[model samples]
Target: MKEKSNRLLSLSAIGLVILFLIAARFLTTAESVRQSFWALVPPIVAITLALITKEVYSSLFLGIVTGGLLYSGYSFEGTLNHVFVDGVISVLSDRWNVGILCFLVTLGAMVQLMNRAGGSAAFGKWAGKHIRTRAGAQIATILLGCLIFIDDYFNCLTVGSVMRSVTDQHRISRAKLAYLIDATAAPVCIIAPISSWAAAVSGFVEGENGMSLFLQTIPFNFYAVFTIAMMLFLVAFRLDYGPMALHERNAVEKEDLFTTEERAGDESLERPLRQKPGEVIDMLVPILSLVLCCVVGMIYTGDFFSGESFIDAFAASNASTGLVLGSFVSLVITLAFYMLRNVLSFNQCMDCLPEGFRQMVPAILILTFAWSLKAMTDSLGAKEYVAAAVKSSATGVLSLLPFLIFLIAVGLAFATGTSWGTFGILIPIVVAVFQGTNHVMLIMSMSACMAGAVCGDHCSPISDTTIMSSAGAECVHLNHVYTQLPYVLTAAAVSALAYLLSGVLAVSGITDNPFVSLFGGLAVLGLVLLGIRGGAGTKAE
Candidate 1:
């Protein structure tokens, strides 16, 4: 009955969308509703339907079609061309997208190789002794994610691969694991001064030293800081709510690793090739090499060997290209290492290439649809509409400007699935908004933009970081998205309130200390956790 009800709801929602598209023709004769509020409707539709139906691919495709209809002014031929040709084909055809896809495929193959060779199994045994509890596993994953703050792309995949075994051994749901992976990726990167995200944000500023400004803004980055805090609180206290709590219960009580059919990978995460130590090197060596090579590849692309400084090279590096080169090299090195170890026969290793690719197919398809949806959203001028709206609001409210900017930034980033783009578009306008009138407010608003962008990116299902995290944890993509949303929203609310207080404080000339809002946000987050988690021990306890 519930399943039937959900289907009915989804169909009704689709019906509404169809009605809207039909009505749009009479409302506008233009080919597209570019640079308008309607520009955001498609992604909103996509996100809503996905959440409602627990279906990702169809939700995204329908979103693409909605954008097509909006952009082509409800013309059938134009909608088809717009969605297929200009949307999906364009995104897949891009070289950067291709590079990332290849990296995912190659990395997937490497993971398969390690599994078949008993390397992963061996590592699980090694970790089993040290990581004795679910909290330890979660915290360890969080620490690894923070440690790899160099790039979100690198952080998500590396943490997922390294930590999966430990997490599964504790019967932690992949949904929860994915939430941890995602919660750390962009949020950690956005605040890390040495990270690729910092580099990207710095380039957007015109007159000021971008890195310096980013550093200054870090204290005011409430969403990022509070997100980290929330994760620790959740794991340390064995607390979860909503879908995640259900997943956790299912994992621990039922021994059901995945509660959904979307699980393409196996409990290979929990199974070991051996209970001994020899095969341990199989997992560690390649992971280490992959990390080493990826960093080297990133710097190489930035022209580090050509005499550029470490930071400068990283700033200039093309992450997509760097990761592809790094993963390809790592795969070759792992294959050779496996052969020499005789853990798997050469032919068996060869077989893993296809198996790995097959395992990654689900991720690839989802990513493609996601990318296509983003393309449609972009073509509709979503970014421009957001920028214009934010600019119009910036000058209207003095005490509320920072909070309003944060909300706008979040909305834009969530809809478009790109935090970098959201901040890139907003940061300049923010700088211009308060250039000389109030220096403190300027900093606060800029920080809000950064914080909100990461927050929105965290919640977005189509976000690259989100997708990568799901792939890394081998979780069903939509399952990860839905489970993670409540956690993200909890932090976002606290951050939003903190920013609002900062704005009010600034109006009272109490803006000198960043710690005011920072500490206050932390307190609120803790209290919320305390209330939600109770005087917590693990669920079993």
Candidate 2:
């Protein structure tokens, strides 16, 4: 009955989208709409349909169509060509995307190899004794996620691979696990000075020490800090609300790691039951090797072997090529280790290859649609629209500038599915707006922008980090998005309020003490959660 209701609701949402498009066709000037609010319709439609319908593929496709129509003046042939030829095919044809897909498949294969060799199971057993409680398991996951701050992609998959078995053993839902992985990924990186995110952010600023500036803004990054705090609070207090609470309840009561059947019976596609005897060392060694090789590969791509500095190499490295190289090497090493240890035969190892590819098929499919939707949104000029909007709106709201920039950044990043792009477009404008004076305002605004970008990325479905987080936890993509949305919104709301306070304080010369605003945001978040839980308790009674 519930499934049927969901299907009907999804259909109704689709119907409404079609009506909206039809109405928009006759009502608006489509071709001349670039850099307008119309440019954001695609991702907005996609995100809304995804939430309402609890599906991703159709929502993204419809969004692509909507974007194509909006970009091409509602011509059917134009939309057909743009949506398919200029959008999906183009993205698929891009070398970077292909490399990322290949990397994902290769990592999938490695995960399968580990499962076939009993490495994952062995680690689970080893971890089970020490990680006896759900809170501890979640804390360990958060720690792993924070530790892998080199890249968000690496953090999501690596943390997921290592912690999946442990979380499953403790009856933690995949949705919750994905939330933890996601909450820790970009949020942690924005503050980690050595991370890819830090480098990406630093590259966006002009005429200043970007790294130094980024560090200065860290104390004011209320969203990222509050997100981490919220995770710890939710886990420690068992204060999950919304869909996540139901998921947690189901997992605790039923030992069901997945609340939905979007995946196979087990969260993993690999057959652990037919595995060979292996110790935790088998798992730890290959994973550690993968991590080391990936770091080396990243620096190698940046010419670290040529005597270049580590930080510069990391800043210059191509994540796709590095990940692919590292994962491929790790896969080869794992297979060879299994053979030498006689834990799995050559045939057995070879057999797991296709199985691993099969396991990651769901993620690949979602990523393809997501990439396509982003392409459509890009083609519709969402970035230009957002940049112009922010620039235009910055004229008179000096006191509210940080809050306004943060909100603009959130909408832009959420629409375009790129935090780097969001900050890149806005940070310069921020610099220009506060040049030669207002140093405190500039730093606070930059932090607000950074926090907003991360928050939006956290909420965006087409975001690579969000997709990878789902893959890491082996959660249904939409389920992860749904369960985590309330948490992201909570953090974002508090952060927005904090930014508002900071923006006002900057104008009043009280911006130096950002901790005051941050603590206030955290307190607000706690109070909000308590109020929500109290309401829920009343309803339960």
Candidate 3:
């Protein structure tokens, strides 16, 4: 009875919000509508509905429809055409999107091949002998995620595939696995000097050596540094709180990793140990091959063969195309290896092609919807609105610039579900502010932008990193978002406070030592975690 009432209430609320949005269309001019707050409404509605109902597909579709309706000014024909044609179709038509989709399918097939050949099961057995504790399993996942910092998408999928069996053997919740994958993905990449993320950030700076500037910002990137610290602390001290705690408790006591009825498309996450035996090399060989090939592919795309240095090639690489090229080669190699080893027949190896596509369908659908929704936001001038707002108020409160930029970046990235978009919109404005005047503050502010963009991407359900994390762990997407939110917020709060202190020091002409701010932030984070740990014990007592 309670469930039914809650459902009714949620539906009622959704209906009211939709009606309000439609009525708002009539109240505002079309020209001003896209540039106004209405540009952010659709994603807000979609995120809200997904959280409220725990149904991502319908919630996302409704959000896309809302964006279409707003874009069309409530016109029936325009709304239908815009939602499918300009939104979904347009996103799917892009070459980058196609490449990413192809990469996903190929990776999925490779994972399937490993499973069918009993490689994953063999690796699980080997891991169980070594990784005897839940903490050990999780730490291993984190380490692997960090090592694969070439790209966040690669990190998520690769880590999830590699670590799932180990974590499951130790009774770690899939949601927790997803959180670990996500925490390591973007945060690690953002700080890694040679990563695709560094390349992207470097491209945004003007009038300075972009790579050198990016290198300087790393120390002041409090969120990225502290997130890794928080993860280590949580694992070391066994401090689980909020929804994650509940999930962890169930996994330990009930041996129920899911803890909810809403498993969705996560059936693919569960592995059945194969009777046909295989070696641990089955898993490691393919994964290593994929990594090496991906690195080569990225440089190749950047014209490395034409004499560019490795770092320069990497900085100029196209991630989507490179990943597709690499994954496809790896997939073909895996098929041949499995057949040659006689662990699987040629026919059996061929069977994984379609099976792999089927497993990835859920991820593909979500990506398509997410991309389409972003299109809707873009069409409505979300970027322009955010850019204008940042530029307008940036003239005042020079000391608060980092703090203000952090907050605004968080909001924009969270709303639009694109950290890169946030970087493109805000970084130049930041560069323009302190470019020649103050290098120290410029670096500080630049770090704030990167940190805030990551924090927002870390938490936003619509983020590709978040989506791929869920897909990789085979956890329900919303479960991953909800369970991870409290932890992300905790880290973000500490990061925000750190930025405030750093900004003040930079403005007052004091010593601009990043270690001072970084250590101070770490101290604050340590205290907060200790408090939470103590409180959890008291509650138990």
Candidate 4:
């Protein structure tokens, strides 16, 4: 009965959307629709459908079709060509996209190898002895995520791989684990000086010392800092609310990490093999090697060996290519190490190759669909429409620009599901808006852009980082999305308020200290959490 109801709802929503699109086609010219508010309709439709139906693949594909139709003026042949040849094929063939796929496959294989070697089981035993509580397990995951601040993709997979055993031992919900992995991924990378996110942000600011500007904006990064603080607070106080609270309760009380019937991955992959138990060093060595090699690979791409400094090379490096090279080397190293330990024969290791690829298939499929959706948005000039909107509204709201920019950024990033693209679009506009006028306001606005972009990426279901987090934790994709959305929105609300306060202060010329707003935001977040905790307690009683 419930399934039938859901199906009917989904169909009704689709019917309404189709009717609206038909009316829109007759109402506006294709070129005008492509360049206006209609450009955002497809993603909004996709997001709404995903949330309502709890299905990602069909939702994304429908969005692609919507985009194709809009871009090609509702011609059936044009829509087919645009969505397939121009959208999916175009993104799949991109060099960087291929590199990311290689990296995912390699990382998946590496994870399978570690599991088969009994390294993961040993680590679980080791952690159970030392970190006995659920809070401890959660905190450890956060700290590990913080340490791998090089790339969001690397952070998601690596942290998830290493910590899943410990988290499972404590009955931590995979949704919770995924949230921790994601919160630490892009947020940590954006704030870190030597990360791929910083490099992307720096590349956007053409005239300024982008690195210096990024560092200066760190204190004003309310979302990232507050998110870290919120995670710790929630853990320390044993607080959980919204869908996450339900997931956690099921996990703690019933030992059901996933309340839903869907198993996102093959549970057998995470199970200990029938071989003798391996040492913890078996897992540690390969992960550490991957990290070191990946860092080197990034720098090498940046011409570090050719005499460029470490930081400079990192800033110029191609993260996708570098990750592929690094993970591939780390795979070879893991294979040799496993052989040396006599954990498995060559045939077993070879068997894991296909097994690992199969494990990553879900993530790969979601990513490809996501990339194609973004392609459709791009073809319709979503960025241009957003940029034009921001520019047109810039004149009278000087004091409120930071807040406005933050809101705009969040909406854009959420719709498009790419923080880097959000930064690319908004950072340049912010720079142009306040390049010579107000340096203080410029810094605040830029910081808001980063914060908003991260916040949106943190929440969006179609986001690659978000998808990777689910893959890493082996959680159902919708479970991760639903569980994390409330937490993300809470943090974003506080960050938005902070941006408003900061913008007002800067415009008033009373104070330009970034910490004024930073500390203020943290205080507000603490109070909000306390209130939530109190409310939850009262309801329980």
Q: Which candidate achieves the best lDDT against the true structure? A: 4
Candidate 1, residues 1-541, lDDT tens digits: the string is: 9879988998988788778777876886544478888888888888888877778888888888888888887788998999999988998999989988998888888888777777777788888998898888888899999888878987887888888888989999999899999989999998887777887888888877777788899999999999999999887666888788788888999977678756747555334343444468888888888988888888888899999999788777888888888888898899888778777678878888887788778778878887888888788887788789887876658889889989988988888788988888899998887777788888899999999999898999878888889989989888898888889999999999999999998887866687998999999999988887774323532
RMSD of each: 2.3, 2.4, 1.8, 1.5
Candidate 1 residue 343 C-alpha distance from true site, Å: 2.7
Ranking by lDDT: 4, 3, 1, 2
Q: How accurate is candidate 4 locally (lDDT)?
A: 0.90
Candidate topping TM-score = 4
Task: Put down candidate 3 lDDT per residue, 47-165, tens digits, no spaces.
Answer: 88888877778888888999988888788999999999999999999998999999999998898888888788889999999998887898899899889999999999999989988
Return the lDDT, model 1, position 332.
86
Model 3's alpha-carbon lDDT is 0.87
Residue 504, model 2, lDDT: 81
What lDDT would each prediction earn against the true structure?
0.84, 0.84, 0.87, 0.90
For residue 206, what is the lDDT in candidate 2? 85
My TM-score estimates for the predictions, one after another, are 0.94, 0.94, 0.97, 0.98
- Which of the two, 1 or 3, has more lDDT? 3
Write candidate 4's Cα lDDT for 364-422 as tens digits. Answer: 99999999999998889898999999899889898798899999999989999999999
TM-score of model 3 relative to the true fold? 0.97
